[model samples]
Target: MRGRVDEKLPMDGEACVQAMMNETTMTKLRAGKKKFKRSYRLQKDRETIVYSPTRHSALPECTKRLPAEQAYDVSNILEVFLSTLTSRSSRVDREKAVGPSNCFSISYKDQTPTLDLICTNPETAQTWVRGIQHLIQSRTGETIVNKKERWISEFFHAADKNQNERLDLKEATGLLKRMNVPISSSHIKERFQEVDQNGNGDLDLEEFGQLYRQLTFRQEVEDLFNRVSSPGGTMTMQDLHRFLTQEQKVQADAETCKRIINTYEQIGDVKANDCLSLQGFTLYLESKDGDIYNHAHDQEYQDMTQPLSHYFIASSHNTYLLEDQLRGPSSKEGYIRALQKGSRFLELDCWDGEGGEPVIYHGHTLTSKVLFKEVIEAINDYAFKASPYPVFLSLENHCSVEQQRTMSAHMRRILGSQICTDSDTPDPSVLPSPHSLRGKIIIKNKKLPPDVLEDEVSDEDEAAEIEDPEVQARMQAEKEKRRKELEKKKKKIKLAKELSDLVNVSQAKHFHSFQHSQEKDMACNMSSITENKAMDLVKRQAADFINHTKRQLVKIYPAGGRVDSSNMDPHVFWAAGCQIVAMNYQTPCDQMDLNLGKFRQNGGCGYVLKPEVLRKDYLKIDTSGKIPDKYRKNLTVRVISSFQLPSPSEKSTSSADPYVKVQICGIPADCAEQRTEWKKNSGFHAVWNVAMTFPLALPELAMLRFEVKDHDSMTASDMLGQFALPVDSIQQGYRHVHLLDKRGGDISPASLFVYISLQAP
Candidate 1:
């Protein structure tokens, strides 16, 4: 039986039980003619689904209740994927399964039988859906965020000019224009042909999704064929070898290249010649068993129980801004984008808004603000989608008393089970691992000391009166401002009490000295240091940092002087075992590129475990210009070939003759930079057989960046594409080096063939 849950009913256990007993109507739940309908009520915590048989009124139901944590999903009967056990139902059976049936199925993670129940009416069906959804939300601490399905609907609606669900070429062009994506009409026609899989002239929403996923794939395959093929559209053996070794960085010898061509022909066309075709190229990329970023080989599963500091966490500074930090508009999309890219730590600068609620934005700047509640909701919804790891919310608070209270209340209520209000460990001697806090939000903020009582200002007033007339007036004004600020601060401190309760796991504090930090038993005392200060420490007390950060968490941020949102080179700080080396995420410069690439290992789950040396208590860092081992020797990278590099712009027909630059960033003394001569008039077949050697002392912390640039005589060279990877993770021998755009997305078909080898000096 189903009815509106009365608002007057008390939320307490006895009241809920009595109400359910009096209201619930027993009905048959038939599955292939077997009835298993049962009456159920939620436990006090609303996490247990307790059920009982209506016939057994004298005896109790099973003591073990169906825990809500076991449930994977809950929805209406029509929404779930149902498999009929018997043959097709008769018309009578079909009639029983309609809206009046109110039959729903709930699958549990445990091997328990799927719960099938029948409700008396539509209200019961609705109540079941809502109740199960609420139970799942509370149990998993998940809230609905920017769902991809909803996003697709919104995107399709915007693109469907005539209000129809289908998009024509003109509508598609308009959609591209709105996204600021430049595409030629010919390219659009070709894409439409490929995307309209059913041979339809226009694309529906699903077909459009297929088009979005393969936009780069189709573009690159055609561009690559154009670059390597002859006028007759066939690539010779030499052409294939050059393209593989020089452009795509496939690490194939001439014979290996021949075999690859043969393999492609075999898979695409058995009756083909010793040549490559567009069909073969497309097949290689689209195949499920293809070598394009294979998760099996690329991802390294490591132990996640190490101390929290023993990892390089993907983090962002001023995460709300997407462009220039000072003038850019802030939106919840920033959080969504960051989390989607597997950034685990996000900084939010909260200030009291016009309303009583708190808002997030760059303080004392022209940047726009996003609602604090919205940001938290977005974070809760998306934090674990990319990586099921804990997310650290670094709060830079500047809210007033009432607003701070509102923020705490909103966070506790909206975040609900996601907010970690207390430590999981009985005695947290060391920082908890990311695995333990999965799907949880840890607040990192300052624990302000007790508010000091205001002292009598009679002595200061008397002293100010004795000064010269102008000086006395200035002193009195300054005193009044200080008094007002102090009073406001006192109020803020008092209001911060509830918020501070949520910060049980991590506390923000000023860093004094390495020894001072070690003496404290605090598992996580996060200290944010300016880039300059961190650099100074690295120069003067590198060992101290290396020692302290092994057990404690340290966040190194950009200096205040960097108003343009320029990022600090994170590798230098990373070498010293810093957990969160934050940078201005708005800037997509070399620093951000390197950051994205280094964390690309470990499945891009946003946390890369530090090397064993960094986690040790006592270890030599080897800073004295002496090679420690073969792994710490000079790395020689040979730039062989690059393929399908993006032109200056999509509209421009002229192909760019590109060259490569290799930058090795790590410990300051180990840093090296080099560049290759431009390949003249090569278009997509740019080949620079240039080799450079980078002396590496600490290879574990090193990041190798390769940038492709178009040579120009009248103006500066434009960046075509770039790829970055940690030197330690690079596979030796011949390898295919996939290229990436500035935003760290894969530039498919655009790759480099490189030879990598290490030599000891």
Candidate 2:
């Protein structure tokens, strides 16, 4: 069991002499020649200072060792000692010894000495200090000094908690997990190899517990023993021998260790290879901001690379976005909201909607019906006008390729022939380029190879081409026969690259990520979200104006696709304020000085917004003597919402409800009534055109809604439906409908019922 213990182990050899001389001798040692001249005068010097302490206080029994002189120069003293004593305290978690836990997070962390140590060279330092001490007291200068003997021995004796000798992997891992100190169990085995005294591969509890607290290397072990062994810091041969064998299976599996490491690392931004905290992973995903979706086709190996943008949100869900999106009917609305929040690029998918007009909505069923023009008009009429940035519309064919073509043709007609086809129709757009439209429209679809033309010449001859060597050589030299035609068969798909220059090329795909969970339960409302719904869209846009704009002026356009397929006019509302606009290009997290800890603890994602329309009716600029003829007109204001105007003090008093007045110039008194004609389209409360006095340039006035938003709308609530999903039924029969919140709330929820029947239908 033990190495051949030579009876004559101590040899007066060079190895013994070399071990004593170390940097400690040079650094901590001092020597000088006094003028003693053969040590004659030092005799008197020693007699004068003859006062001595008791034997117990003497150097040998001082019981408090000073740091040892360094072991003399060598490449590495520890490595040599380790070779002499191969005792390695390695008790790797053997999962075969254990079993798997029930749950796991996706990511993990690594918290080991290797990862944590920023020191230059640690192992070498521990060796020199311990090696010399062992030689003096323990009779052997081996640096290895483990005293553990039982794997089940208590590692933490100071604690009065549940006692277990040589803790198992689960217990150890759990301890580290709670401390947020992530590291694999395997690391402990590797570390033990450096400190094991005997060649044994394990350690007992005593050795392990001692090593955990008192095994730091500061002086030569034997020297410390000889100098002050009574006061501690010295290890006997038995202690050294015991420490090496005190190993236990703390984490019984590599996976378990890895998981613990991952959890800790994620919490502290530590790298556990792949383990990510559930919340951390969400934050990471949100940080991507759909960049994968925004990546261009020009990217290298586009097909193979999974973008950060297209993260698998759920097992049955994958969202392909060219920008801000999740591939659902809500994508368009999401994009618009992104813009409101300040995004540069917005993305949405376009499909044939009601009235055969291309409209934007994501689901297979129906949704808000709004014409393209309504969105554009709302943009124009808003308190804030839209920015020049383009909206990217990816038009797809839920219908057949032929139907797609028909829609394309119709698109060109309504868009003033700005949409054009390429290849077959060479010349693209004439007005500006469709591609130059603040954004782009891409027509995406799968294409089969075009069919090939029939062969013009036939080879009916059945003669074999082979011939004898001599005859073939002579015949081939003069064989200039008519070239045979090759049959080139290929599938063809007619693509419409029209108006591509004006808008953007609409790309296509035959792929769809998610499908209806219960197909049989879904009824057809295919036409509900179509361009025909633009009529309702117009109403929606007009309502937004009532909410945020002062324009009482009204106009009606057909409810259908006007441009990029979104319900611009009807579905969106505006907020009035000193809109926050950020410059300097800081990311969402950076600008906000977000608490990364809090962000991860709670679900967090990055966000940005692009200001489309910015209206400045609040601040008035006076251009004194600036272009005289261009100025000088009395201003007029219109009534938007329908409610009694609050008294100046009452309207201006409430914090929950905000009220303000804006002035409009260039309006006829006759048209003034047209602006205030009370109707369903008016907002909650508004005032019509009022004659003004004073330099009335900056007139003092007020406006407000008298009544609060009715909570009875579903039963009847206004603010209730603000963020709720739209109704699936747009038909003419009043039917009760219910919507549920899967998140489960103790407060008032979406259980309120509403009846919706298309008045027109």
lDDT by residue (1-761, candidate 2, tens digit) is 11121224343333433332322111110112111001001011011101112222212333444333221211111111111211132211111111211111010011101000010122322233233223333323211111111111212321213533343434443433322222356765454554445646543354444333222221222332343212333322232222212211021344543433343333553342333333332222122111111112112221211111111000000011212111212322233333332232222234455565554443222234333332322222211112322222223323333445555555544333223233322322211221143322222233322342221211111011212243334446444441121122112333333322323222221111113212311110011122233233323333232212121111111122221122222111111111111111111111111111111110112111101121223423221112222222332222122221111222222211212222121111111111113222222222232322211111111111111132222243232111121111011111111211111111111111111211110
Task: State the displacement of the C-alpha of residue 59, model 1, in Å, after optimal TM-score superposition.
Answer: 64
- List the candidates' TM-scores in order: 0.61, 0.18
User: lDDT tens digits, residues 1-761, model 1?
Assistant: 12233334334434333343233543434434455335665433233344655544433334554334221212111121111122353111211132333444453322223445556654454455455544344323221111223334455665665656798877876665443334567887798898787786888877876665454334435666687767776676677777655654446676775666655553344315667666555444333123223333256487788778888899988788877655677876577667867788998888889868799887545678889988987786667878988889988777765787788898888788888755464445778888888788888876543452221111101011112333334456476664555344322334367676677567876677877887863766777776787888888887778777888889888765565778988988887778898866657788989888878788888999987777877665633234456556778888767756766654354567688888998777678889888876554566676788887877777888889888887788878788887876666544556777776654544667566776576
677 Cα displacement, candidate 1 (Å): 0.7
Q: Model 1: runs farther than 4 Å from truth?
A: 1-300, 448-495, 622-627, 650-653, 758-761
> How displaced is residue 681 in candidate 1, in Å?
1.7
What TM-score number comes out for model 2? 0.18
Clashes of each: 7, 123
Q: Give lDDT: candidate 2, residue 58.
A: 16
